[model samples]
Target: MSSRPLEPKDPGLSFGGGARAVLPLTIAVAGFGISYGVLARSAGFPPLAAVVMSATTFAGSAQFASASILEGGGAVASAVTAAVLLNARYGPIGVTVAPVIEGGFWRRFLIAQLVVDESWAIAHRGDGRFDLRRLIGAGLVLYAAWTSSTAVGALGGEFLGDPNVLGLDAAFPALFLALLWPQLRNARAIAAALLGAGIASTLIPVAPPGVPIVAASVACLVGLRR
Candidate 1:
């Protein structure tokens, strides 16, 4: 008997599956969002402005860095510079995922807005190809979680007291480590990580907040040379 040909997966099903796969990570993202909301409020942002920043920026690290800089009396230019540096990783991420994104100009442009580290990682199927449905789905879920959590945190910031007192300050770093740990399976990755860490740690005291992260991230070039 002849076997039937395989059918393409339904986009909705793929989207749902992707969302489910990323749900666990989204929990951590929510926690980070809440922390960011608290931090933003403490940094002198109005609750609405804090929520708006999270909605528009959708970058926890950059948002946090900018808020911290602003809180420390840094100029707006300095905060913007830090945010730009911290978000530079998205350039590579966008390039890597660009070919797999299916759409017209506007569609691609909208999708590009969702290309954060978490969605990028989840969209990569480990075969140099991306699952677009998963990418979009995961992005939607994460975006909603992040933005809503930010709103909740910002509104409740008054009652949350010190975010540090509740240890929320550790959530973002912990989530990032959890994400990075899975990708360090090779010597090159390990070496790059160590180099980046060393560089950032050494520069932390002297360089501006996000500058060290950007400088250390250059270690990723080591992988390209291999």
Candidate 2:
């Protein structure tokens, strides 16, 4: 009898699958990153500093809120507060995927850093669990796109001159609607989305920058009743 050597395990999960699934969204994310870079640069952030923020912070809405506040002559403390409030949603998002992310402390921390909205949405298997492989794959590539595009916009943003002029500002709303479109199949979901949007629009005129968003998120509580 001949003994065969051990074969490497192939879990059959392709990290590339997640990367590919998110590829289309990656383009939109890049556009959004470029818009942010332009805004950050216009807000007086150096190109390097803007890129670093995108690389490290990796939270598009929060970064935009912070930069918008700064551009409006708001104080650093106010900007920080707005950013923090905008990112509070991540606390819940992180908890949802904490169990599937198996690793030691440092490994877990590193993986957790990759749990942005795009990766999180794409990686969820929709069965009350997540695909760790998909999460890591989608995250790494998205991170690269975000940081590099930020550099492009920050460095060359001067020539672009007002992201809105070129319709770059549309990237954000477009990206979000794309993401939201997939999840709006059910009536409950559709209602929740409409309610959230209505809440946000109503508050936008009267509330502070981040308050409208946070307030609109209360519509998610509607999901709990079912």
What is the C-alpha local distance difference test score of each model?
A: 0.77, 0.78
C-alpha displacement of 171 in model 2, angstroms? Answer: 6.3
> What is the per-residue lDDT of model 1 for residues 29-78, given as tens digits with 9 covering 90 to 100?
77778878888888999999998998888988899999999999899998
Worst 10 residues of 2 by lDDT: 1-10
lDDT of 1 at 2: 8
Summarize candidate 2's per-residue lDDT along 1-226 as a digit string, tens digits: 0011112233323588668767877777787788889899889999999999998899888999999889999999999998887787777779879998887999999999999887876666543357788789889989999999899999885564444565655755665666566566677778889999999999888877657766876887777876
Ten consecutive residues with minimal summed lDDT in candidate 1?
1-10
In candidate 1, which residue ranges exceed 4 Å CA deviation?
1-13, 161-226
TM-score of 2: 0.75
Point out where model 2 deviates above 4 Å. Answer: 1-13, 161-226
